[model samples]
Target: MEILSFVAAIAVGFVILSWSADRLIEVASTLASRLGMSILTIGMTIVAFGTSAPELLVSSVAALDGSAGIAIGNALGSNIINIGLVLALCGVIYPLVVSRRIITRELPLLGLVVAFSLALMLDGDLSQTDGFILAGALVAYCYYLARHSGGDSEDDEEVVILSISTARAVVESLVLLALLMGSSKLLVWGASELARSFGISEVIIGLTVIAFGTSLPEMAAALASARKGLFDLVMATVIGSNIFNLLGVLAFPGILSGGLKIDSLVIQRDGLAMAGLTAALAIIVVSSLSMGNTDKASGSTLSLRRAACSYIPRYKSAILLACFAGYMTILGISALA
Candidate 1:
């Protein structure tokens, strides 16, 4: 049946995107380690930025194709999903204790970017000036991280050397990058085609279907990190990646938009959704931090038992399903309105 074929194509796209993202992360992590970058820097810069490649590719291509709604919707919707759907589930899976480092440094930066994004959207469009400001902010944020994150000291003997040779790392990074690009292309194309075939608007496709397709990497990474007991890393990936999505991925296409214009509905609906999600994430993080500090100050210790017991039984898949449902509802209302 045509339905079965469509489902099969979506399944294949998911597999390709998830697999490519894993390889890309692996290659990028190894490359950063080999180049003597701090793990924090690697996480914040390379891993965070690398995982956002899908968004970058999607938005850039959509902008070029004059599908500004697709470009903007994908970025805005993914920002919501990344924080709400990804980080919330990350916390639910394992109570993520917010590190002081993240709270003092990255959290503020994330908030700043979100504020900047909202200010731009209030003008009823993303002007070239807005794009320039965002891109400039991204550059400054990256520079701040590089300077304050402090590259690993030359004297730290505990730093592990990468097993892969430089040549191999280079080859792997390039190959994975190519594969990611190809898969993204296929995903964007198939998504548009499927939307047209189903008589769905491109905005709906971008908000629900395309956003999830592009978020395959974050889903895989979060699940993998959860399994490894690296809950903080999972949170970091989601939070940091969302920040990059707003500033880095959105800015590039916005700059190239000449003068971005769209329906106020984008800001009215998706913008509020994105803000609500980010706020939920902040509450979760802040709650966890408070709980963690109380325990630490009272000379209590944390264990897997406490974390596992404290989880409120929300899985990543559940969050994802709920997000999908919510997105569908939003689309339904938008289409009808």
Candidate 2:
């Protein structure tokens, strides 16, 4: 009964989490638009940060609770899920077009960030110094993106600006943020209890259950974006979320706890898997760039015209799904052992 209660709590928490995140993004986007922010600015800062709020809150709470395993696991696991599961699934649904800017800038930045994170964790602990470094990188990356994002694109026109008053929007944003933080606490608590009941390590629970649950918002967004043929948005969201997870979400735990200890399995298994996935994404983007399928539309703006043959083929997406399956299999075996 106790286990069932925890399971139920997780389910409820996830539903609230997804709903609240979507609401937060909507209100925040509208607020940004009202404040005379460009669509690029809104997308890069408000929407990106809103989607990552759950992960950030959960990791912080876990760290405060002294569950370093869950804290670190949530961060690494979310990155893997974002790429391996979320983006791969998006590709399968509709082959994503690779943009030159994303390939030349964001992907490489992600690679370097992942490498930096791994180096920091090499000592089997994520110290406050490491946290500060990661956090600093996140801020720098966001600033770089803002400066280079260029003016509004065609997609920006599609954003629906809400007609609410500024004071109301501010109040709503605060309410949504409070709900998100509360739901995050419920998720972490439920996950920890569930792990205890099942005799599984908190890390495993974090990696599988909590990771998947927290990622529901991304999955929903990806699928919806794919259905609407907003492939670039889907790609941007995944890439942005992963970077935020590593640098922003992960940093909080280390900073709050002074130093969060990492399990060997986390570094050896999950860390390598994350790095490999990041590399694969980079390879995909770079290969697409070299295919001569893209065109320079304006200064610093490259337009990707979808060919009859997609740069990200369905077969490649299948392979990503296969990799995801293999990783899950390894995790299952380890949990049982």
Error of 2 at 197 (Å): 1.0
lDDT of each: 0.66, 0.73
lDDT of 2 by residue, 135-197 (tens): 999889888876765544333444566789888988987787666656655776777666667
Provide the lDDT at 276 for model 2. Answer: 87
Clash count for each candidate, listed in order shown:
0, 0
Estimate candidate 2's alpha-carbon lDDT, on a 0 to 1 scale.
Answer: 0.73
The residue-level lDDT of candidate 2 at 330 comes to 95
Regions of model 1 farther than 4 Å from truth = 1-8, 23-38, 151-162, 290-328
| Structural similarity to truth (TM-score) of each candidate | 0.80, 0.81
Estimate candidate 1's RMSD in Å. 5.0
Clashing pairs in 2: none
